[model samples]
Target: MKLAALVIAAACLLAPPSLAAPWLRTRGLGRVINGTATDIADFPWMASMQILDNSGCGASVISSTWALTAAHCVLASQEMPGAYTTLRVGSSSRASGGVRLDVAQMIKHADFHMSTDDADNDIGVIQASEPFPLGSSVQVVNLPGDGYDAPAGLPVTISGWGATATEFNPVYLQRADMHVLDRDTCRDMMADVATVTLGMVCAGDPTMAICYGDSGSPLVYGDMQIGIASWTRPGCISTTSVYTSVGNFRAWIRDNTGV
Candidate 1:
């Protein structure tokens, strides 16, 4: 299927537009909100991959030995030699007892097109050198599959240490509550995309949207994770925040990453 068509079909059951001025710009500093683990040490896989100093990307643990993130995050590195050499996954707050697993392999979504707005198959998996310790307090998020579908209007939780506002990446993690948007509503919101397809899911309020730093963060609904923050329009505050729907590609993801 075409990228736009995939986004529409993938999100045919999902649901974007006004914008509010960004409140503040966080410089790699994240806030630990309520319900979040009290100690930074608790979240072992909630990491920020550093390309220099900025939190260029975010990733979540999906299995003891694998992590899920955006395909774009490792595309360049995979294409080149030794580009992602220092990539690390651990608490963005600091490096302590957290494991620094080398990215033994990277698998990008075949349909991902970096030049286009469509994020078809924008997902990717990073295999860690070692399995995350079972009782290490690092919990792997379960992915949505086998008829998993979030009901419309359901409230979902999305967390990231990305930029709090526009043009900046936060230093600490933050969580936001968002509602799922159906395909029709999202298409209208993504009117500029030429076409909205079946591989994408839209989330967040029109006024409060995910930003650049949030790419690859999990969009959790209930016990299953359904989406990954993939991209936002030119302005992060735009009503439509495109996500790579996990449910739509569950089989493909499992096959490629062997998770």
Candidate 2:
């Protein structure tokens, strides 16, 4: 299929605006493929990108006032702002009850360039207008310590509100069990599409993949947030979902957010 068609198909799975606002009572994505529904409290750090009133992407709380997400989710250019107006954090339901904070600032990596065939340095940070009151329902996720590397074949969990099937976006959050793939294997798989960088981590199964609206969601291993949902093959099936490695960008995140 054409890349555009794939993108459109992926977008339908990732961010379908027709669905009810996540906070409101309305029903929900194929992008989460073969995943199960989860409770908001399970992943309290989860965030939703609210563009106008619609939830289009996912994010994670790294500190009381800081969130981590994908660069393409928040940057129009080095000088322009992203499409999202707010970061809805502290909720797994995508909507429902969560602090909807105005995005005080969006700091994408200076080296990030989306124009490339691959989304290089596809990571960014969001500063909330105010600190989130950390509690049972709201909390911060631990970033990997220095020199940390995810072991290949290590099982991990990914959560998001992306489509569960073609044109289906869920009202509640979803989770899938996946495993880390060796970088070389990931690179070869992506050679026909985009260049796979060391800064990226790859995971997924033929039965499960990340699709459109899932961009920016967290890939959790143990209690640490290791990856940010970046991209996957069009149709979101039988392809490895790529993530921006949090361990690779730990220094950058600390320098920018100081937490």
lDDT for each residue of candidate 1 in 1-259, tens digit (9 for 90 to 100): 0000011111111111121111112222222222231243434446554433334566778887888877766563455333442234555452234455566777887777655444467788877777765445466777877445556687886766554432143455566677888867887877665345677787766555565456666777764688777765544546556677888888977897766
Worst 10 residues of 1 by lDDT: 1-10
lDDT of 1: 0.57
Model 2: per-residue Cα lDDT over 1-259, one tens digit each: 1000011122233223442211111132233446788877888888887654566668899998999988866752222233446777667666667778888888988897654364668888988898876888778989998656687898988887776664455677888888888989988987755778889888877677776567788999966998898866555654567888999888999899897
Ten-residue stretch with the least lDDT total in model 2: 1-10
What do the candidate models score in CA lDDT, each in turn? 0.57, 0.70
In angstroms, give how far residue 25 of model 2 lies from its true place: 28
* TM-score versus the correct structure, for each prediction: 0.76, 0.84
